[model samples]
Target: MSQPKKTFNDLKKDIIDNQICTSCGTCEAVCPVNAIELKNTIPNLIGNCIECGICYANCPSASFDADDMDQKVFGRTRKPIEKLTGIYQKAYQAKTTQEDIHSKAQDGGVVTALLTQFLNEGGDAVIVADLEEDKIWVPKPKVAKTREEVIKAAGTKYTPSPALVGVKQAVKIEKLEKIAVVGTTCQMRGLSLATDGPLKNKKIADAVALKIGLFCMETFNYDDYMQYLKDNDVDPGQVTKFEIKNGRFYAWNGEERLHRAKLANVKPLIRSTCSHCTDFTSEYSDISVGNVGSPAGHSTVIVRNEKGQKILDAAIKSGLIEAILIEDFDKEETLVHKLAEMKKSSHQ
Candidate 1:
């Protein structure tokens, strides 16, 4: 006889209770009965259960087929030497040509530029993390359909938002035909789970058109982080931007650095779930972008597949962005590799 089917209770026991849930909202977004919802950083079951087990089956923290996902998305598994940057066709130092985006972007504005161009070219929507309720630090998932919308969502929020939920909104609620995603490493892995292997969700597989993933060290514990800021005499509302650079976290008001923290001092504030995740550069993404391994005004971009190459090339050809080989690569150690190595080793 067949074994009993697993359900949300199984997810709770295996992932939530163990504190291994990545808070990607994979269960919330893919739930057939709309039974699951994420409140802050925790997942709760609110509606009647259908016992479909999609939530249990698709949660990245619970079940991720890296080799299968790699083979399906890239036509091969990542080689042993490809541990840090994963599989990529090319790597570049890139910056956006759009002045407006450059002004608001955390670093290079390459992500905003590419998404804007894609939307202009008839892409349906982009699901991105946006600041919620005029708060500088609280990010919420958004479905952006135009250039202005995409621009507003530009910049990195150190906290984690369940961005995958926007996929559900984009595909099911809005009935969008083509969708692109801009998210962190865990979120990218969440996408990989939905589009590849035995637990594949056809809705996501058919709709998602691009993946633009950010480099991440970890997601913060919101309460702990807010307390740290309060103790430092920094009010979250006064901050104009939040930045993480060279092992330091900065709260900035335009050109003024309002407050700063050494990464180690804030280690206690990092979410416990992040300790279980090893992906630092969003290796599952078609294109990954980050501030490391590039010049001050540019982002280091990893193009992993034909689709990523096509978009990056088109962005350059359209004068929306410019690119060059990473500077001084032959002269020094690559920062991206070092961080990737650190995160993987420590997390494991």
Candidate 2:
């Protein structure tokens, strides 16, 4: 029997009012009608609620089942040693071969390199986050169809952007056949739910051909984040890049250091939903990449399945990226594992 659908009121009681909404904006993305929207960093009903249940069902914070997701994505559950990182076929320290990408990207520019390779090989569209030039650090979702579009959307935004909204546009609006999505762990969970979900044939879900997840500890609210920076005497408008590292958050423009603050000071600005997130490596992604354990100009990539492995192999063969493989997992020495443990313990 088809289950009775839960409405946005259920979502409100369960997640939004509780202040645990991740603000990944999957709700807005998957909404069958343009009834939902995010105001500030919270989902608000802008139009009539239809009680479709897709928004609630697809929310990582609302309906995410970690164990069921692991089994669905990898065909197995986490082993004893794989508790922190979900399932991985291999691990590597990787970087982009293009100087332009490496110069502007957040970590190693590997994600951009991957997108370039994907688009070059006939990917119909890609969902990426783009910043408004007039609004400094503000971010919005973009459906990119060309290599230039992918390169333009490079870099990290400490504030969350609903990049998955591009999926809806790519699949339903543009009628794209294949699309790649790059997002943080929570957003990845939402994507995996829609794509590999029991309701698997959703148009937006079926259109996702590649999923690349970034390792994220947390994201901040936009207005509060900017005010915090302003309180530090930093102009948010001039800052070109944002990064959190070694106990500090930094704002930079090219080689010029604009401002920085202790990571502890930004606590009040972090999204409340971050504390509830347990998947640090985007365990459900086909490939997960981040800046945690790699060299200054490289990314730590956890290749999670045969699809990821094959893509990495082909990208390497094409000379689009350079990678060094890690033969075995190390618990004590790796920062990624340590950080993963830290992120997981938050849920307990």
Q: Evaluated with TM-score, which candidate comes out highest? A: 1
**lDDT tens digits, residues 112-183, model 2?**
999888888899978899987677688888888898889999999888888666676788778999999999
Give the per-residue lDDT of model 1 (tens digit) for 1-33.
987778999998989999888888878888888
RMSD of each: 1.9, 1.9
lDDT of each: 0.86, 0.85
Candidate 2 regions exceeding 4 Å error are 1-4, 330-333
Error of model 2, residue 69, in angstroms? 1.0
- Tell me the spans in candidate 1 whose CA falls farther than 4 Å from its real position: 1-3, 134-136, 327-333
